[model samples]
Target: MANSPHGGILKDLYIRDEPLKATLQAEAETLPHVVLTERQLCDLELILNGGFSPLQGFHTQAEYTSVVTTSRLPSGALWTIPIYLDINRAHLDTLGAVPGSRLTLRDPRDDQPLAIITISDIYTVDRTQEALQVYGTTDEAHPAVHYLRHNTRDTLVGGDVQAVNAPQHYDYVAIRRSPNEVRQLFKKLNWTRVVAFQTRNPMHRAHRELTVRAARMRHANVLIQPVVGLTKPGDIDHFTRVRVYQAIMPKYPNGMAQLSLLPLAMRMGGPREAVWHAIIRKNFGATHFIVGRDHAGPGSNSQGVDFYGPYEAQDLVLKYRDELDIEVVPFQMLTYLPDTDEYQPINEVAEGVKTLNISGTELRRRLKTGAPIPEWFSYPEVVRILREANPPRDHQGFTVFLTGLHASGKESIARALQVALNQEGGRSVSLLLGETIRQELSSELGYTKRERDINVARIGFVAAELTRSGAACIAAPIAPYNEARQQVRKQVARAGGFYLVHVATPLEACIKNDRAGVYARAIAGDIKGFTGIDDVYEAPSNADLVADVTKTSISQIVHEIILLLERDGYIGDR
Candidate 1:
């Protein structure tokens, strides 16, 4: 029989009363609309489908307090994570949110009504306490802590959601199984003893060996469950990772393993998250769960220290194994014994024995260099999928972002570079010069700080999309703020390589060389908030290439950029 759900019963809030649901939907049109963020959407779907088995809706203040303090619901059920609906303080006041108040929850992707939430409590949150208690740190470097400190709202509105419709997904329909579906699948497969393995990364030979070993030791079938929802920033995207998973599924012994996608928006909460995952897997009918070193750990903080101890997740899961109702099958890091042509736990190797292991950084470097990835390290099919997702650096798309003073030879250098690249004729090149982008993408945006940030963000989005499609994007914007420039770098880096070129032409030189008289107008007080005249320009300290247009010819500048690209393997020798 399948293991019972976390709270002994799965919560179902789908709108079964057609007439009442119709009335609620119509009434929602008249009520305030609260668009669900990605995290909230994941929570809502899981709640509706009983993946978050006991969570009827977003938590009230009492439940939140209980869960955070004790890792248990108010009903004394195991629920390590707190699910809350947060709204801006102003929005809460405008909506007159109080106990018993109703609001419409709309999907941000489609603006379709997904649920109607009745406010049960409105309470202030201590972000630091929540972060420290839930994630074991109050540091903003932690992604969840950062979200709590900066992105989330000050006021949290607790509510019970009545589902109008589950959120829609356009991809991977067959394997996007709900808890009930997974339970049914387990039954169909006669998987009485199942071991669940959770991951946010692509699977390779080491991972396969680890999971298979765990399943064998536990005498259970394997369920390779990977999170397809919001993982830590900079993780391999689910689309690519899922393809990698599909490629490696055949390597597992027939009838010994299965693959499923879990739409979990992980907080990277380390130890607490491991317990949460165990309870979730138990609800999915798994008898055992594999928790390895640093399970679900977000790599490190800004200080270069691990957020959790290496064995912290395993220890915590072991502490709650009985209550979680799932066997905790802890495993050590696996290393390949090249001599034996197999893998074993790193700790199990003999004192004089040699072992082979590839760090993630080393693997990425090898992939970028098109170096040999030995078949012993990973299967050829798996390597092929990864190589396609992350092409060799020279073959991959990239963005060259130019930031400088308004009249600093950025446009000229960009145009010259575009022409030079076009002449090379290897890849598609796009030029987003300052004036062109201001006229096209940001015509309505002004030069205010927020507007400038938005403008740069728009450029980043465009560049990232183009880079993903294997096009070289040359974005020349007077992105004067360091923070905004850094944001764009991070955004574009995810899709492809990002190189920043600081066109460091002197301010006086730029003003003197200006033919459009925009800089002169800014100095003459006709133009307000112009960069480098009245407003300050925060120069990039870590630009990949710094070209002084006054000292270097345009051709030289273009050559310098090409040389940087070539050095970085974004382009072949030219």
Candidate 2:
């Protein structure tokens, strides 16, 4: 039989009463609302669907503290991760939130109310403490830690959430099963001994081999549950991964495996996350879960050390095996033996026999360069799917973001680069000048820091879309703040390459070359909050290339940018 949920009871919090749901929805429309972030939305979906069983709502301060410090809920249940409804202080005050008050949680993509929470506690948290206790690091290099420090808000409001409606998901509707639905399907299939395989990456030949081997070893059927929600920052997007999963489904022996999608916002917390994954799988009706080396591990710290030991996840899952009520199937790195045409665990391989393997980095490199991938490494259909999703770099899209002081020849350089790319003629090139974007996109915005950030973000959105559609986009906006530039970089990076070029022309040189005389007016106090005058211009320290217009002509600078792109394989040799 399938193991029981983590707390022996599944907490499906969705309100089934039609009249009550309508009443709550109507009341929520009048209440102060918090727009949920992507991670929060994912968490809310699972919570309402009983995937995160035993919890009916976001944790109160005490529960959060208990989970953080002791890796357990207040009731001593093994809940390693904290679920919070984080809000900024300004928003908290705006809502006038207090105990016994109600607040609506709306989707950011659209203003649809998904749930209403009765505020039970309103408190602030020490983010650094939470980061250390939950993610084991305060270093911002870790993705989850970075999110904790920067992206997440300071204050957390805890309450019992009443779901008016489940979060809407239009994709993969057939495979996106709730806990109850999955349990029913397992029962229908008579799958009592089911082993779950958790993955956040595209499955390959070796992955199939290991999963099949694991199921056989456990004497159980297989549940290929891949995460479709937020994973590591640079991981392949879920759409492509899902397509790959679909293509690989027929390869599994008939009736031996099933596929399900988990809308989980992974912390990449390694050992603790592995235990958490096992519990979630158990709630989904799995009798066992496979924990591999460095399970859910974020790559490396800034100091170039792994956040957790390779076997740490396996060890932790084993430690909690009895309490978790699920078997922990441990597997090591698997490599292919060409002579035997089979895969074996690294430790099980003989000393003299030849073994082959491909790292994720190597696989990406091969994909980007359109290099030949050996059939032994991946199935042809899988490789074909990945190749289609990730075309050769020359055919892929990219962005060149130019940021510097006003009148620093950024516009001229950008125009010249656009012409150069047009002449090369592989892809369409777009030039987004600061003044043009200001007049067209942000006509009502001024030169304040926040407005400038919004303007730059608008430019980034356009550039990112263009890049995603396989175009070369050159944006020359005087993005003065490092934070805004970094945000643009991240936005563009999701599609393809992002190159930041710093036109490091000095203040005196910019003033000397000023054609608009705006800089002089700002110096004369005719303009308030002018960048580089009353306002500060935070130059980018992480630029891919730095050009000084005083030292080089615009044409030469454009040539240098082209060379940089060519060197990075964003463009091919002309």
Candidate 1 Cα errors over 4 Å, as ranges: 1-8, 16-23, 403-408, 438-458, 477-487, 506-543
> Between which residue pairs do clashes occur in model 2?
none
The most accurate candidate by lDDT is 2
Tens digits of per-residue lDDT, candidate 2, 453-545, equal 999999999999999999999999889899988988999998888999999999999999998899889999999988888888898888899
- lDDT (C-alpha) at residue 67 in model 1: 92
Q: Kindly list the per-residue Cα lDDT of model 1 for residues 1-574, writing each as its tens digit.
A: 2343222455567777899988877887888878988998888888888788778889999999999888999899988989988888898788787789899899999999888888888898777889978998888889999988877877888877887877889999999987777878887887778889999988889999999899888778899999999999878889989998998999988899889999999999999999999888877778888999999898888899999999999999998878877889999999988788889898899988889888899988898788989998888988888888778877778899999997799989999999988887678999998788889989998889999999999999999999988889999999989999989998898888899999999999999989989987888899999899889899899999999988989999999889888888888842
Q: Which numbered prediction scores highest in TM-score against the true structure?
A: 1
Worst 10 residues of 2 by lDDT: 1-10
* Model 2 misplaced stretches (Cα beyond 4 Å): 1-11, 402-413, 445-455, 477-487, 500-555
Taking all chains together, each candidate's TM-score versus the true structure is 0.90, 0.89
